[model samples]
Target: MDMLFSLMSPQVFLLSCMVALLAGVIKGMVGFAMPMILISGLSSLISPELALAGLILPTVLTNGWQALRQGHAAAWGSVKRFRVFLLVGLVALLISAQLVRVIPHWVMLLLIGGPVSVFSIIQLLGWQFRLPERGHGWVEAGIGGFAGFLGGMSGVWGPPTVLYLTALDTAKTEQMRIQGVIYGLGAVALFGAHIGSGVVRAETLPFSVALLVPALAGTWLGFQIQDRIDQVAFKKATLLILLIAALNLVRRALIG
Candidate 1:
């Protein structure tokens, strides 16, 4: 508790709690965006290094909750189905996390921003493509690598994973499960990777653990609200938020 509270000022600490709560609500509703929200929101108020560490524990714990929410059988099924993607993605995440400790902050922002903006715009513009069935395995590997690299560097890999799954025409139920499985394992990989990279050291780990409460609590609350939303409207709203966030990332990168 002392170590966690020592990581930030009272004002900044309250802001982080709000950020975690909002990010949790969005994730609970849409099944993605917690890291993006946390990293992006916190970056302004704190060093990105500390913010990166702060997101780790909550992300890992919450993703684990999501993966097992439907029970072991469903979770395992999704894992088996996307085994290639998970394997490639997690490996890439582990390797690339090492790079994060060396890279400049602005460069990381460009990486996160560039892909997010392009993808969000593409998704909103309704461009469509279908992969030849047999070649999709390789495509999945590629997507996983890209997602993992992004995940390692920016603490976000959702956009590419979502695009790949969306392109594969995965049904709604399976898509969520697939996302949960991918993110859960990636979170595990991230925890391990960062431990060695010093992103999960004692000072940072406490702050991360402290935020888990708001993150998880707000997620549960958001799940209750998810059932009340219209799918079409909610999707448009989500995209708008992504676009805004993506642009903000770019702006930050440029100004720095």
Candidate 2:
């Protein structure tokens, strides 16, 4: 309790928990964006490093839940199918994860905010990004590397991953499962990477752990809504909200 309070006041801590819950709910409904939401929201209340730390364990656990929701075999199949992306992404993530320790906060925010805003705007424009029907190995590796670089630094790689999946015209269910598998693995890499980077150390770890309950609960609620709602409608709305949040991040990066 003493350690947690040192990070934030009681009211601020409660707000951070709300952010986690909101992030989880969005993740459940759309199959991605939890890290974006967590980072964008929590960074408002705490230092980016602490916010990053706060998200680490919840990201790992929630993505694990998402990946295994369909069972191990399906998750393994996704791993096999996207092996190139996974391998490249993990390597890039490992390399770039170290940057967080030295990168300026505003630069980090801009890096996250810029790409996310573009992604959200492009998605909102109804432009269906497409790829050829043939070999995608090189493309996979490229986007994977980029996503991993961002993920390592900011705990965000969803925009590019979603774009790649969208380009493939992947099925909704398969896309969701693949997202779970990919992000789950990425989150695990992030966990290990940040641990080595000293972002997820003793003082910050408990706050991350404390957030798990609300995250889980909100994800469960989102799952229920996901089953019944018009997903396209819901996704569009979510993107709009993301656009707002993303632009706010950009604003902070530039002016604040």
Every model's TM-score: 0.92, 0.93
Error in Å for residue 147 of model 2: 0.6
Sliding window of 10 residues with minimal summed lDDT for model 1: 127-136
Which regions of candidate 2 are displaced past 4 Å?
Answer: 234-242
Q: For candidate 2, write residues 101-206 as lDDT tens digits.
A: 7888789778767877898798889876688746878999999999999899988887778778867777666777899899989999999999999999989999
**Model 1 over residues 94-140: C-alpha lDDT tens digits?**
88999997888788778777877887788789875555545578888
Q: How many residue pairs clash in each candidate?
A: 0, 0
Give the whole-model CA lDDT for all candidates, comma-separated.
0.81, 0.85
